[model samples]
Target: MHDPEHGDGTSLADRPHRRRAVDNQRRSAASADQVHRAMVAVRERTPTGWHAAARQHIDGALHAFEVEPVSGCIDAVACLIPPRCGFCGWRVQVGTYRIGFAVYRDGGARVASFATAGDALGAAIRAVGKEIAGTAHR
Candidate 1:
């Protein structure tokens, strides 16, 4: 496949953005797995005040709960921490310095800046969502 944007002989996966989106998906999946493990722990333990509080904010998987996304963000679980993708689980933080986004991990952003955060995020979500629907990716 030929990409007009990069006429040089480079494969699609070799492109920075092509690789980056994949990396974001990989990290997002990892975050989701981590959250699922924690949720499992919460389920198996003697329920405590702290566990109950954390679960209140998480509210389980995206389908397990309903949310009214007011902004580009998924929900209002305190902006200090970018809430999980819900489908997965900072997970893709948006900044206004010329408008950009990144995948958050290890308490920092992974620097996946794009030309427009909303467009790219929404497009990626819709595209990937359609493909991964009713499966583990959802």
Candidate 2:
């Protein structure tokens, strides 16, 4: 007997299973695309170099060697050192400089020079948070 619904001799019982399999494949593809977009967004928002390093140190991903208040420089100054590597230490110096605040990494690599130290610190913190959150999403 011909099954009008299926047209062919294929069992009615098999139709639902095939439909489900097709649906699952579509859903999986959509999920993968969403993940790729999220990763791209995170990459675009996150900063690189010493800013990133400083963020990692603040987030506890890298060990902090020292974070201390300084004198004879700016109104408010703080120096941070990441853990030593052999004999070399990575440092982040944030302080008021000239007309604004300046954040410098080791060897005078400037992460950013902003109107306020708060702005610089906020930028670093936001970058680190985005990185950590992005990994979690992945």
Q: Write the per-residue lDDT of candidate 2 for residues 1-138, one digit (tens) a residue.
A: 345554666566877766666665564554344334333333443344322212223321333212222222213333332223232323334433323233444487455443322333344444334444544575
Flag clash pairs in model 1.
84-89
After the best TM-score superposition of candidate 2, give how far the Cα of residue 89 lies from its true spot, in angstroms. 43
Winning candidate number (lDDT): 2
Candidate 2: pairs in clash: none
- lDDT: worst 10-residue window of model 2: 65-74
TM-score per candidate: 0.28, 0.27
Q: What TM-score does structure 1 among the candidates reach?
A: 0.28
lDDT of 1 by residue, 1-138 (tens): 665554656676678776565667665555455444444333343122111112122322221111112333221211112234342232333223233333334456443322332322333343233333423353
Q: Score candidate 1 by lDDT.
A: 0.35
Question: What are the RMSDs of all candidates, in order?
Answer: 16.6, 19.7
